[model samples]
Structures are given as structure tokens and as C-alpha cells.
Target: MQIKDRINAFINLGKFLSEIDTESNPILNKAEAENGWFTQDNINFALNSWAKALSEENIKQWLSNYNLETTAQRSKIVAIIMAGNVPLVGFHDFLSVLITGNKALVKLSSNDKTLLPYLANHLISIEPKFKNLIEFTEGRLQNFDAVIATGSNNTARYFDYYFGKYPNIIRKNRNSVAVLTGNETEDELTKLANDIFRYFGLGCRNVSKIYIPENYNFEAFFKAMFSWKEIINNNKYINNYDYNKAVYLMDSFPLLDNEFMLLKEDNGFSSPISVVFYEKYTSLESLKKNLKESELHIQCIVSKAGIPNEVPFGKAQNPELWDYADGVDTVDFLLKLP
Candidate 1:
């Protein structure tokens, strides 16, 4: 199919998914009953991003960034081993593969097995030519023209060993951050709260931690965030938070708290499960050095400064159209490969 035809198909698909009962599907429904997960909202988030990615200006810009042609000239085969920290975590990779006119062999995560199949069906329905391009499988993948794999730190080593030997882009576990200059507006803090709390803070894109100016006032941050206390009070999220809080407190670990804040210093690349950690930075210079020292562990960057210039910050879980993990344009490269 033509580029315009494919792009229109995805836009139409988004309009369709906006109203469907995501929980009606067995794969998606399980996450909801089991964890009170908001699958529909997660699906909607991806669909929104899909629509954005398909926009003519945005698509053209993204392709130009990747040094890719927009006339759908490539026809390579791509095997995408998608990570599923949250629902539709693999959607970006799928979009990259589809829009670039490559065969995509996608392997879905057990945690989020529903949305991929549903979207795959929808794509085929929208552009039947894509019917031959998208396939969901659990089987061993080929060396293929290119392979894009996203997984944990441990599993990433395995992906590196196997796929690294080939023309592949294998992503390891990465985290986002929020840099607080102590000048953040309430609305900015509120948006940061969404970055932290959405998807119950399960996605790697979730801002698992923060970097604030040393001795900055967190009182304002808490005041702004707790305004959406209903989200903080969510059972799914509170369970993770409370459980981690109890463990840290029981261990006699020191932390600051009011009703909605957890403040502490951590040495690990990430905090314990369900907990958000913070480290102090005296200046942006030191922050840059810290990121340089921690380069292998960082992911997307979020800030009020439009697109990020550093490795990562506050926009941990919600990635925009161009925010591929590991700072690589794996999809565009895959499709462009000769």
C-alpha cells in the first residue's frame, strides 16, 4: 500500500479503538481484573501517539531524522522482540516497522499479550497489504535484515549475545528522570505526577526517580501532586507504594514523607520495586556528568524544554512519537538496511 494509504489506515484504526471496551478482550481484561489496570486508557495513549506519528509533518520529520526515505521503498524483514512493562509498550516498534514497509515479526509480552493482536488485526483490516507484513509469533526469530529487541538488564545481555552478532538494536532496561530546578510551576509538577504515577508506575518509561537541586523545596511538589490524590490513592499504585514503604521503613531506612512523597538517596540505577527514588544535584553541569557516568542505564528525557537534550527525565513512561529507547532509531535503520 502507499504511504498515504497506510497512514490513513492507522488514523482510522485509532478512531475505532477510542471507543472499544478494551476489557472485553480476554488478554486485556486479565490485567484489569488482576491489577485494576486501565487497559483502555493505555490503549488510548498509544493510539494517540500513533495518530501523532502518522501525521504528515511528524512522519516526514521522523523519517528525515532517521535518514529514511518516505516513499516506502524498503522491504526488509524485521524481528521485533518487544518488552511489555505496560500495555502497548511495543506499539512504537510496531508503528516503525509498519510505516517503513517492512515485514514485522513481533513477539508479545505475556503481561500485555492482548493489545498487539488486537492492533495487528485492526491494521490488517485497515490496509490488507499489511496483512502479509505483520505476524505475531513465539517461535525463534531469524537473523533477518534487522532485529530490534527490548528487554531487562539481564535479558539484554542475552539479546546482546545473540542479536548483537547481527545487524540488531537490542535495548536494555532504562529509566527516565525529572530534573527539578525548584522553579517548576504547579501544572508542570502535575504533569510530572502523571509521568510518575501513570500505569501504576510499571513502565520503564515511568519516571522511576528524580534529580532535584539539593535542598529544594518538595513541599510545593507534594502540594501540587496530591491535588490528584485520587490517582495516588489508586489501589494498584498504593499497594506497590505502601508495600515498598513498609519494607524500607522496617529496615530502618530513612525517608521523608508527608502523605504523598517518598524522598531518599539511592545508589542503584533504579529504586526498589514500587518505590520512586531521588538524588541531589547541585548544578546542571554535575547532572550532565552524572548522566555520562550512568549512560548505559538511562532512557528518555522529559522536561519543559520541549524535546530533551539529556538522556532522561520526568517523562518516564509516556514516550512521544520520536522517543525510541537507547537513543537509537532501530526501526528506521532496519527498514533502510540494504
Candidate 2:
């Protein structure tokens, strides 16, 4: 299909997704059954974000940032190994491959088996031409030229060994963080709660940890986060909270708890669900240096600290089309594929 047709198809797909009501939508109900993690609210959040991002204006603006003439030379089979951490986590890669006029050979993550296929079917229906461009695999992936794989750090090693021969973009585990200066208003902190609790903190974009200034009071921070107290009602999240809290108590690790979430002093970036790691920073210069040194493990930073390229509070999960994961330009990579 032509690029315009492909873009329009996705735009329509987004509209369709925006209309899905999990309480009454049959397709979403089926998806929820396939994976309990794909709850109505989480799935809707993901869909609505995509719908906003895939607008005709946004798509045109994103494409304007890249050269498209090179992508017209030939169509290659781009293999995509998707991740199931959040709903439609791998949709960006799939969209990138097709928007560049290439075929997609996708291996759906078993954790996210049903949703993409349902969306793919909708895409094909919108434009029959897409029927020839998209394919989902149940077994081994074959007849593909280049590959884009997203997995944990361990699986990344395996991917490097297996798909190493092909031109590839292999993504490993990464987490997002927030840097708080203790001057944030209640509104900003409340928004920050969305960054921390969205999707049950399973997405790479979720703020798994934060850096607070030395002597910062926790009262305002905890009070702002109280808006998300209902999260404790989620069985899966409560289980994780209880388990991690018990582990911390057993090990005599000092922790700050507000009954629903645990705040622990840690130097780590990746925190468990229902837990957010924190560190006290005495100086911005030192924090900047440390962040620069460990940049590879971070996906995005949320703060009003004026750090270069830092995503604003509460906006981490609502990334634009050009916010490619790992800072690797997917469209640029696809356009240059030989």
C-alpha cells in the first residue's frame, strides 16, 4: 500500500480503538481473558495515547522530520519480536516498518497475543492492501531481512547471538526516572503520580525511581501521591507490595510506607511494582554526572530540573511519535535499510 493509505489506515484504527469500551466491548473482553494484565483501564490508556499520536497532523509532522524518498527504493521484510510489558508496547516498531513501505513479519508476545492481531485485522479491513504487508507468526520466524527485537537484558544477549547476522536493532531492559527538587507543586506531584502508577508501573516509561534533594520533606510528596491510593485494590499490585515489604522487613532494610506503596532508599533504577526507589541528591552537578555515566540504563527522565531532554512530569507515558525507544531513530534506521 502507498504511504498515505498506510497512514490513513492507522488513523482509522486509532479511531476504532478510541471507541472501545472495555466494560461492553467484546474484543477487549476477549483480550482481557487472554491476559489478565490487559485490564480495561490500562488497555484504554494505551489506545487513547496511540490515537492521539497517530493523528494525520502528528504523522505528517513526524514524517517531515525524516527523508522518505530513500524508503521507496524497495520493500524488505522487517521482522519484529514484540514485548508484552504493556498493551501495544511493540506497535511503534510495527508502524515504523510499514510506514517505511516494508513488510512486517511479527512475532506477537504470548503475554500480548490477542490485541495486536485484532488491530491488524481492523487495519486490513480498512485497507485491503495491508493484508499483503502484515503477517503474524506462531512458530519460527523466516524469510525476513532485518530484525527489531525488544526484550530483557538476558534475552537481548540471546537475540544478539541469534539475529546478530542480520541488520538489527536490539533493545534491552531500561527504566525511566524522576528528579525532584522538592519545590514541585501539589498539581505537578499529582501528575507525577500518573507517571509512577500508570499501567501498574510495568512500562519502560513508568517512573520506577526518583531523586529527591537532601532534607526534602516526604509529607507533601506522599500527600500528592495519595490520589493513587486506590491502586492497592489491584490484587496483583497488592501482592507485589506485600511481598516486597515483607522482604524488606526481613532484611532490616529501612523503608517508608504509606500503606499502599513503599518508598525505599536505593541506588537502583529498576524498582518493583508498588515500590519506588529513591536517592537523596546533595548537588545537581553530581546528580547530572552520575545520570550521564549511567545513561544506558535509563529510558527517559521526568523533572522540572531543566535537565537537557528531560521529559516533563506526567508526560512520560504520552510520548510523541518521534520519541523512539533507546533514543535510536527507528524511522531513520528503516529508511536506510539495505
Number of the predicted model whose lDDT against the real structure is largest: 2
Candidate 2: the clashing residue pairs are none
Candidate 2 local lDDT, 221-278, one digit each (tens): 9999999999898888899999999999999999999999999999999999899999
Residue-level error in angstroms, candidate 1, position 317: 4.8
Error of 1 at 306 (Å): 11
Stretches of candidate 1 exceeding 4 Å from the true structure = 18-39, 64-74, 232-234, 304-318
Compared to the true structure, candidate 1 yields what TM-score?
0.86
The residue pairs found clashing in candidate 1 are 177-313, 177-314, 178-314, 205-316, 205-317, 206-316, 206-317, 300-312, 301-312, 301-313
TM-scores, in order shown? Answer: 0.86, 0.98
Best model per TM-score: 2
Candidate 1 per-residue C-alpha lDDT over 138-186 given as tens digits, one digit per residue, 9 for 90 to 100: 7888647778888888998998888776677787778776667787787
